[model samples]
Target: MTLAKAAAEVRERAWVPYSRFKVGAAIRAASGKVYAGCNVENVAYPEGTCAEAGAIAAMCAGGDYKIAEVYVIADSPEPVPCCGGCRQKIAEFAGPDVRVTMATTDGKEKTVTVAELLPGVFSAAHMDRA
Candidate 1:
């Protein structure tokens, strides 16, 4: 399935009883496989898992460490951007030039590269002793 279709399809399965807000994410791994995930909420509020993180986990479990592209969908008036944490997680697996597409259920969409999404992102490069 296409990234958008996979995200939209999985969105219906979000476990968001607390907030009633749902989100879905799909990632195209460097292996050329598509992995989809839906938000999973917890009673502890912020303990809930974002869809992007779930999708990234699935990609890793599927043995793909690199992300080629990403798509996230939500039921909002406008395309919803990834949460701060998800942006960093995505940057860890995707190149600075990788495209991330955000979309609303109503058809509105926004696309930005990883660098644009998280300018001055912190990476392993910062850990180098040299």
Candidate 2:
């Protein structure tokens, strides 16, 4: 299926009871495989991660380190960009030019590159040896 379709499909499964805010993400890897994930929330709040992060984690588990494209869908009118943590997680697998798309339930959409989303991003490469 297409990235948009996958994202929407995942969005339908989001488990958000507290805020009733649902979001979904679809990640395409260099291998031409796509993984879909929906946000899973916990009552603990901060413990919950975005659907993008979950998708990236699943992709990493399968040894795919190159995200070709990433799409996110949310229920809001404005496009919801990945959080700081998710952006860092995305950088761990995708390249600087990795495609990132954001969409709202109202059909509004926007596309950006990973580097564009997180300019001057800090990565593990910046870490020094102990």
Candidate 3:
């Protein structure tokens, strides 16, 4: 499925009973494989993971670490882009110019790159390799 369709499908199946705020995310890996995920919220919010996180986990579990594109969906009037944490995660795999598509419940979509979404983002490149 396309990024938009995958994210939409994931959103339709998000598990956010507590927050009643569902979210969906889809990412295209360097392998040209598309992965989709839905928010799985727990009663203990801290235990919950974002849709992007889930997608990354799924891809990693399948031996994919490179991301090419990403799409997010949320039922809100305003643009529901990926969170700061999610942005960092995406940066680990997605390129600085990787495309990120965010869509709101109102059908409005915002497209940008990782740099546009998270300027001056931190990454492993800053760390010392032992």
CA-only RMSD, every prediction: 0.6, 1.5, 1.5
Error of 2 at 18 (Å): 0.6
**TM-scores of the candidates in the order shown:** 0.98, 0.93, 0.93
lDDT string, candidate 2, 2-113, tens digits: 9999999989999898888999999999999998888999999777768998888878887887899999999897999999888888888889999899999889999999
Error in Å for residue 86 of model 1: 0.3
- Cα lDDT tens digits for candidate 1, 1-130: 8999999999999999988999999999988999999999999878989999999999999999999999999999999999999999999999999999999999999999999999999999999996
- The positional error of residue 57 in candidate 2, measured at the CA in angstroms, is 1.5
lDDT (Cα atoms) of all candidates against the true structure: 0.97, 0.90, 0.90
Clashing pairs in 2: none
Which run of 10 residues does model 3 get worst, by summed lDDT? 121-130
Please give the distance, in angstroms, between residue 87's alpha carbon in candidate 3 and its true position after superposition. 0.8
Clashes of each: 0, 0, 0
lDDT of 1: 0.97
Clashing pairs in 1: none
TM-score of candidate 3 on Cα atoms, chains taken together: 0.93
TM-score attained by model 2:
0.93
Please tell me which model should have the higher TM-score, number 1 or number 2: 1
Candidate 3 on 1-130: residue-level lDDT in tens?
7988888888899988899999999999999888999999888758999999999998898889999999998999887878889999999888899999999867899999999999998877679687
